[model samples]
Target: MGEFNLPVKQGYGENQKTSCIKCVLWGKVAEAYAPNIKKGDLLVVSGEFYVEEWVSDSGKRLQPTIIVNQIQLAKKSGDKQGQAAPTQPKATEPPVDFDNDLNIPF
Candidate 1:
């Protein structure tokens, strides 16, 4: 089993506050789902939320966690499966003179 911190947003616009929630991914689900998740990528996660309380030598601690049942990458409104997301154009000029700009005068 592996753990991940998911950032949650509260409210909207200027009132938005972000918080990290602990999530646990395990077994075949983790192996398959983890790879596709990228940093800052939106995800749709469904699971059970629980808190674990324990007493240690010094004090008591409570840990909040989500036992993940399903995880999927959240797609933009126009995104379609098996199709590449639209990318911005890399400059308005042609690529023929690209090497000339990188000659580095060194």
Candidate 2:
């Protein structure tokens, strides 16, 4: 239901403007991930690409779409590899007093 644009490199040391291509994801795949994703977030997607033709009140247009099957968020640059991420510390139990108790039955 949504689309994203990625810049492409035409040549070495040369920058050229590229057209924006639209990609679409469907079914439960889209519903499950659409809300979680945000703009400017890096992602790695595996899917099939195709061209879709449609006619609207304006005119006929062609849009490139990718049917995403798997999507994953890319790790940030500063994140270290082979290291476990930190977690919140658990609460400690209250200490018990045993010395104050006096029970002698011999």
**Top candidate by TM-score:** 1
**C-alpha local distance difference test of each model:** 0.63, 0.54
- Candidate 2 lDDT tens digits, 1-106: 4556644435445565566555555544555566666776556665767788989999998877666555666655566753343321221321112223222121
Question: Candidate 1 regions off by >4 Å?
Answer: 54-61, 76-106
lDDT of 1 by residue, 11-60 (tens): 99999998777887665556556666678766777776888789999899
Error of 2 at 78 (Å): 4.2
TM-score against truth, every candidate: 0.59, 0.53
Give the residue spans of candidate 2 off by over 4 A: 1-10, 55-60, 78-106
Native-vs-model 1 lDDT? 0.63
